[model samples]
Target: MKKTYVLDTNVLLQDPQAIFTFDEHEVVIPAIVLEEVDSKKRNMDELGRNARETSRIIDRFREAGELYKGVPLPNGGKFRIELNHRSFSKLEEIFLERTNDNRILAVALNLHLEAKKENKEVVLVSKDILMRVKADALGLKAEDFLNERAVQEDSIYDGFQEWEVGEEQLNEFYREGRLQIPEDKKKMVYPNEFIVMKNSINPSQSALGIVRSNQQVIEKCWYQEENAWGISPRNAQQIMAFELLFRQDIQLITMVGKAGTGKTLLALATGLMQVEDLGLYKKMLVARPIVPLGNDIGYLPGEKEEKLKPWMQPIYDNLEFLFDVKKSEDLDKILSGIGSIQVEALTYIRGRSIPEQLIFIDEAQNLTKHEVKTILTRVGEGSKVILLGDPQQIDHPYLDEFNNGLIHVVEKFKDYSLSGHVKLLKGERSSLAQLSADLL
Candidate 1:
């Protein structure tokens, strides 16, 4: 049966194209949602951009028909902007305040009551978890806008898999440097997926290999035990990360791990090695999202670089370690001496085509899928991009472990040969930190 989906302002801001997602179902945008969207349009961030896009989308629909009445969508659904002129007396008894959320909920509640008279299903779609809870409290159906969710947390690809094989096959793999996976196992593997081949009878005997999807074969990793810059892989996952990071064949590399998994350290070390030692790229560009904890960078009193220092301090710390500079002055001197490295904010990366550069985007979990797409599209010819993040440490309000851009790119590019991903399980920061990460 057809149902009505009431869209919350956050749903539109999270995805501007959310209006078209509910196929053949009525999509209602409350007037208060438009007011909320308009309030954010003047801001200077991704939310403002999305707010404007939402307005433009509605305006395009307005050109076709009266949006207040209803506009016929191409997908056989009707799009309408609802104005709730009804009295808030009932809501006041429950909420006791006429807040924006309560007003939006009023619109959905009114629709639900009207739909009930006609025996029609009505649901409120929102990205706000609390709003959904409120809608449910009011005896209305509510759901999350889930079109952007690429995978569930448990079902997310872990970048590596173990395959049991005969001891002879494992020996043949070591001898010939390649092994043909059986048809059943090949069906389960993806391109560039890390594979640990273990002897069927002896679990201790294992060899690490990567799947070549096109060839239907598993090949040995080239950079096993290899050091990038002065940093050596401390674990098998890090070894896989180093191989993916150093390989010119893989243009994109994504690393997901906890706080102490050396996500940024490995990327910076490999980026320095590629840009300075091997001269593989003309410059090394390191950028990260400026998601602040309390105050934004704009509130800080300093120039752009100085304002970004605190947010970018983690990047500087890794660079200082990689360059072996202990003091602040020495670190500045070393960074100035190496003119090939550029550390900037992700905001400054827009409207520029970066070519012949090795780009490292740190704290990638804090970015939306759209933001990540914009950054990736900025990569010019002969440039390689590495995204480093711990999904569990996401600061972005609308992003989570499964839906963040880091995992989105990891999942989307899993089947492609040009991209590689590694999820580091070990926390090499310290024993205390590792224990805390595990226990906490």
Candidate 2:
């Protein structure tokens, strides 16, 4: 049966093109939602850009016909501006306040009452968890906007799989430097994905390999036999991470792990080796989004680099360890002396062509899908981008574990040979830190 979808303001703000996603269904935009979107249109951020785009989409649709009534959408759905269902009589007794959320709920509630008379379904769509709960309490159908999610929470690809094989086959693989997987197993693997071949009889005996684009063969992993800028892989996952981080053919890589899994450190180490040691790239640029506790960087005092010192401190710590700068001012002298190494905020990354650079975007889990797309589009020819983040630690209000930019790119680019990802398990920071990451 066909149903009506009532989208909340947050949904449009997250994705401006959401109107065309629903196929052959009725899409209603409440007047209150328009009011909320208009209020956010002046702010200069992703939300503001989305708000402006949403208004422009609505206005462009208005040229077709009267939007207050109904207009034909290209996706075979009808779009309308809900004007009559703003009454608050039913919600005032329980919700008590006439806030924006309550007003949006009132519109949905009134629509539900009308739809019940016709024996049709009216669903309220939102990204806010509390809004869905409140809608359920009011006996109205509610759902989360899931078009942005590439995979379910449990079904997310972690880029590592274990295959059980006989000891002879494992030995043959080690001898020949390649192994042909079973047909059933080959169907489940992706290009550039890491595979751990474990002995069927002896679980302790295992060999690590990576799946090539063919998906039927597992090739030997490119482990860091030599130290990468004084840092070596401590575990199997880090070993897999090193291959993806250092490979020149793979232009895009993503590493997901806990807080202390050395994701950032490994990325910095590999970047330094390639940019400074081998001179494969002309420069090394590290950038991260400014989203965390407390105020933004504008509230702080000093020059651009001085203002970024607090956010870029972790990058400096990794550099300090890699460079073996014993003196307090040693790292500073190296940074000032080296022209190839650069660090900056992700806010200024827009509208520039970054060429011949090794780019690392740390704490990338804080970025949204559009933000990630913007940053990636800025990469010019002969540039590599590495996104490192812990999905468990997210600070963005609109993003979560499954929908953030880091996991989004990981899932979308898994099939292509140009991108590779690995989710680090064992934390190599310290015993206490590992325990806290697991327990907390």
lDDT of each: 0.87, 0.89
lDDT of 2 by residue, 1-440 (tens): 78899999999998998899999999999899999999989867788888999999999997999988999988888999888655579988889988989888988999999999999999999999999999999999999988888686657788989988999999999999998878888779999999898999999999999998579889998664657878999999999999998889999999999989999999998888898889999999998788731224786888888898888888888889888988748998898898888988887878999999999999999888888998899999999999999887888877788888888899999999899999999999999999999999
| lDDT per residue (tens digit) for residues 1-440 in model 1 | 99999998989988999999999999999999999999989877888888999999999997898989999998999999999748466688899889998988888888888889999999999888999998899999999888888785547778899888899999999999999878877678888889988899999999999888483999999988778778999988988898899889899998888889888898888888888889999999888888721224677887977888887889988877877877878988888888898988887677899999998988898888888988999999999999988888878877777888888998899888899888999999899999999988
For model 1, name the residue pairs that clash: none
State which candidate has the highest TM-score: 1
Question: Model 1 off-target regions past 4 Å?
Answer: 85-87, 152-154, 213-215, 292-298
Give candidate 2's error at residue 352 in angstroms: 1.7
